[model samples]
Target chain A: MTALSSPATPWKPSVLRLGLHRAALEIKLFNRDVLSLVLVLFFPILMLSLFGTVFGDEPVFGADPSGQGGITPAHYYLPGMLALSTILSGFQNLSSYVATERFNGTVKRLAGTPLPAASYFLGKTGQTLYLIVAQTALLLLAARFLFNVPMPDEPGQWALVAGLMVLSTAAWATVAIAFTALPKSAQSASTLAVLPVLLLSFTSGVYFPFSQLPDWLQSVTNFFPLRWTAGAFRSVFLPPQFAAAEPGGSYGVGTAFVVLAVWVVAGAVLARLAFKWPPQK
Target chain B: MRTPAPGSAADAITVRDLRKTYRLPKGGTLAAVDGLDLAIGAGETYALLGPNGAGKSTTIEILEGHRRADSGDIRVLGTPPWKAAPAFRARIGIVLQEATDSGELRVSEALGSLARCFPAPRPVAEVIAAVGLDGKESVRISTLSGGQRRRLDVALGIIGNPEVLFLDEPTTGFDPAARRQFWELIRSLGEGGTTIVLTTHYLDEAEQLADRIGVINQGRLIAEGTPADIGGPELRIPRVRWRDAAGHHEETTASPAALIRDISDGGRREPLDLAVVRPSLEDIYLQLIDSNRQEPALTGARP
Candidate 1:
């Protein structure tokens, strides 16, 4: 009876410490759901494999008619896959996972616990980064071995890719967290979340080159963060001259940074406002 | 036992004029809890028995800090839950109607991760054992049956070594065996002097476990007392029934024998299919909720 001290004046653990524990739990749970794995990992890798095989070794854009001294379609589409994978991991996977949790009463149970809300969210943040980084690495490896997509020559190009990865993860993860509140049930989470990402990936040029789209469609893509994401990624993967072939005749890298950062801030605010537990009534 | 008024000493939870009103979709408001008052003393196992949508869950959720009351003076562990500190949450454990959403983690994994968040949690092994989840510790939550998941839910709730525990419809989908097993687990916890407040529509469950029962209907406490004496003397009166040439008839009375004699006309004639029976707790509960339906709906609720 006397082994442990009584909880007379209840003490709280540090949020940072608990948050790490939560993150660990989150990572373990990541692979447990088949749907989650498909949403974040398989969909993009499969897309890359299919696209690279379909357009193998063919110099599509920024290539000479002789198909020499220019980028292959595989190389061009590889970066788009990376950008698309990052958002899929960050947004689509996150929304569906949390929506299921809410519908199943996991969120409600956690809210009743002593765990700080910040710690719960911190765990989600950790899960998003882990998924994005893991999915990107795997997608890139598949592209190289499967299609022989070449890497950028400069180390600085790789660093830029990493930075954009961070921005995109933050922007889309927060938006997905907010989006969970919009779905009335877990069944709708997949459709509601994936539809927008699928649409934007088209408008943002993940499905094909931005220059191939209609003029009106090109202008419409300007309003989305993915537009910047796909462009920034292309700037790194393709030769610098290809930047001139972009919508603005340049990579628009600075604007890419700005758009993604804006989404990061706005998404954070909306997530705070819209987060809900199960049994909405 | 008599409950001291709200704000009295040693009360684990107290509510004065608590009200929660929700806006109806078309036009109007439903006062889920309207001017309800409650007081539960420390170490008491109080069962709030109510039908669905009676505001029992609503009241408990408000007490659990998951929702805010539209208007009320409420306190759990001497602090209003909405404004309470982290310590407030630490001192209280909650079992929701549905358990955790994900079935991804093993039993040990889910309990261990949550246990780390508390300053002094019950050992994961101990919680699992307490909830009768010993051999299943390594099993994934999804693989466990519904009853096992509920035991895990209780394990999560009590892992914090909470001073007070709130169980909201904790045994809703359980089989007879599982329900009885859950009652044993709860009874053991109550014996350890933990303050337990549970909500269930099952009257027999209240009779088996609760030290006191409060019957809530239409968001108000219709009756509060020991299970044997609940619904007051009037609701507990015995009934006599018989069939005559005219038709089947039933009569309620404190003295069923006298009523039976009158119906049989002093033994000169027998009332066909005559029977006298004492009302069970279930009867009292049904009558209680039914009586509430006949009452006026308007509570002068403010917009």
Candidate 2:
């Protein structure tokens, strides 16, 4: 008979260590999936560069003709682009990847392992963080060099941007995990993620200034995290005079932070309640 | 780390009154497993044979800790598998029916990464060689053939050095030569003292590898015994045949030797074209399943 033999040496595993190993593999796979990488990392940059060139030299119709045009449409569009990229990294990409893993029995195999479910969750979310950081860096560098958008000059502004990036990514990633339960297959999951994110982007000022939209429509975006993400980025990146383009015309930095914090707390709770480790049949 | 002392429990697996039911789309529930009982000794190979929707996979999944039973007690490796304790998982392995769908990883990379999950994993190179994928170690999983992917799944299952291995239809995609090779691998694993619980439709596979066979139908264990005894004492029945001037003649009897002698009783030294035949395992298995399905007593016994 085969006895239940233990290992000769004792080794204890923590969530962090196990998650790091899983995250390492996940990051490697992400690096190999050229299509996913291009979508998450380069799609936003490509769109920003294309649109930046188209609008950089043209003057906005509403701005004073004699004011030396303090900010071009490209400068106005950079914050929104960053916000869209964050959504793509955290929500769209993550939901599709998770759904595929579940559909293909990868999630089932992992669940059978000795690793904790928390480790798997943390590992995938960590990969999301890595992607978002890379996407943000590439986008910012592109905007600075290709469009001559100024870098955040103050230390406090840099801190705010860093904080916003972390909070928004974490919040959207949690919601993405929760939303994955709704899709029955990987293909449907990808399509599901795209439609809502695209719609949210249009309404959340990802392609245009929020103040330019109607009053009722502006009030509608107040409920979504994407709007706050865009607002937060604009507060950090755009010139102070550009505050007139945002709702309330003062760059409500405090509201941006508070609304995002609410999303983080609420999203974490919802995801915890809705997420299923093995998925349903 | 704690080691289980030798001979603490002779049985590696024990189950009592297991039951599971799934709700159908039309709001009625179908019982997938009902009142099933099984006990397999340590170091013994048990093959669970059943037809489709016969609850074979559900029973194995319950034992593998991948699914929960509606009501039952199942002890594997001295603990209820449903607890899913990591310590318990480290001592058990499973090869699921579907091949693992890891497309992007190379063979070596997949093994290396999964090895970290266990406290003491077998060497990656050794496991690769064991499953006959030595030269294909660098090949991407997407590029592997169906048979090769199944081998990788087996490799992952054994890499943890588990005592109890549960294989759910592990040879579905294997070609003839590959199937024979896999049987050799399984025999070696059993010889090394792993308690194997297997589910397959191949009766020959069961006859070749299992110490005992359990045939289930409609959530009930219809028959259980050694391969020879599972078909009942009628297994000894043999058909005696011969060709004569009149025609060919055949007769089934429990004593084929006596019947043959009687046929040559007229002082004839030999009988022309004489032969005796015994029923194969496949024939007996089909009869058992067919008889069980025809029994009206087995219906409406869901729980």
lDDT of 1 by residue, A1-281 (tens): 54357646456668898888888788878867676787677888887777767767676656767866677667878778888987788888888888888888878777777778888888888888788888888878877787777777788988999999989888998899888888887889878987988799888888777877899988888877887888999888877787767876877899999989899999999988888532245
True contacts kept of each: 0.76, 0.52
lDDT of 2 by residue, B205-244 (tens): 9998888888888888887777877867765478899988
Against the true structure, what is every candidate's RMSD?
Answer: 4.6, 4.3
DockQ leader: 2
TM-score of chain B of each: 0.88, 0.92
Listed in order, the DockQ scores are 0.50, 0.52
Where does candidate 1 clash, by residue pair? none
lDDT of candidates 1 onward, in order: 0.83, 0.83
Candidate 1 residue runs with Cα over 4 Å from true position: A1-10, A58-61, A144-146, A276-281, B1-7, B239-276, B295-303
Which regions in candidate 2 have their CA more than 4 angstroms from the true location? Answer: A1-12, A58-62, A278-280, B1-8, B242-250, B265-273, B298-303
